[model samples]
Target: MTVMAKPRPTGQPGYSETLPRAAESAAVARRLVRTALAAWGLEDQIDDAVVVITELVSNAVDHGRLTSIRVVVSRPTEDWVRLAVVDRSMAVPLMRTDTNDDRIRGRGLLLVDRLTERWGTDRYRWGKQVWADLRCESAR
Candidate 1:
């Protein structure tokens, strides 16, 4: 995705990273989210946020043919934390419903939907960004 870097107002802290689009990147992404949340004193949100980010990263790696993927984590306001995953695929993420109960996969977006306050995708010239917003106040 063609994400433009915007300046964070005074004390807002954010973390952004680009990693190779490999299976291992999902774990790295989770760790990054965990560390960022801990640093921001939002550890209570870490578990859910990590799960959301892991799913996003996994989806990007599975669908996007790009060599690398970018992840952005930021607290846009005191009440909300945003996590975004960008990959070089123009296709947006869709929720899958056909998988049987025995299937071990096809439930990433479902989990995200249930956990996040809101989630959506933004299309860019280069690709697309899938993002989820978590309510910080509710998290606590």
Candidate 2:
């Protein structure tokens, strides 16, 4: 389920929704990203943003060890939109280069790395937030 909450009061274009930590959450995350980018006039970013969010959400759902996760979409600047998945795990994500054609897993982060301007994790007392930034080419 997608929660319709107001943007935070920080004067930034941001939207967040809490979702159950399951594989299906990725679909909800994608929709949230599409809506946010379209509203911000960054429709060009929807495709990549969807992939990034799906990987982030999948990682969280599979490895976060929590009951629920939060998806955050924010326009940090006119030329950049940030997508993040917050979960109750402090384990940092590692990119693996050992996956061969036989392996169907472990390539998610690689896709994220190639598609985003930058991506990283922010550790908090309660959990961690993995985020990726997509540059709004049309804004430049």
Give the per-residue lDDT of model 1 (tens digit) for 34-134.
98888778889998999999999999999997799999998887788899999999998998877678888879999999999999999999999999999
**lDDT at 35 for candidate 2?**
88
Q: Candidate 2's C-alpha lDDT?
A: 0.89
- In candidate 1 the C-alpha lDDT for residue 73 amounts to 92
Q: After superposition, how far is residue 123 of candidate 2 from its true place, in Å?
A: 0.8
Q: Which 10 successive residues of model 2 have the least lDDT summed?
A: 6-15
Clashes of 1: 0
TM-score of 2: 0.88
- Which residue pairs does candidate 2 place in steric collision? none
Those runs of model 1 whose alpha carbons end farther than 4 Å from true positions after fitting are: 1-11, 99-101, 138-140
In model 2, where do residues sit more than 4 Å from their true spots? 1-11
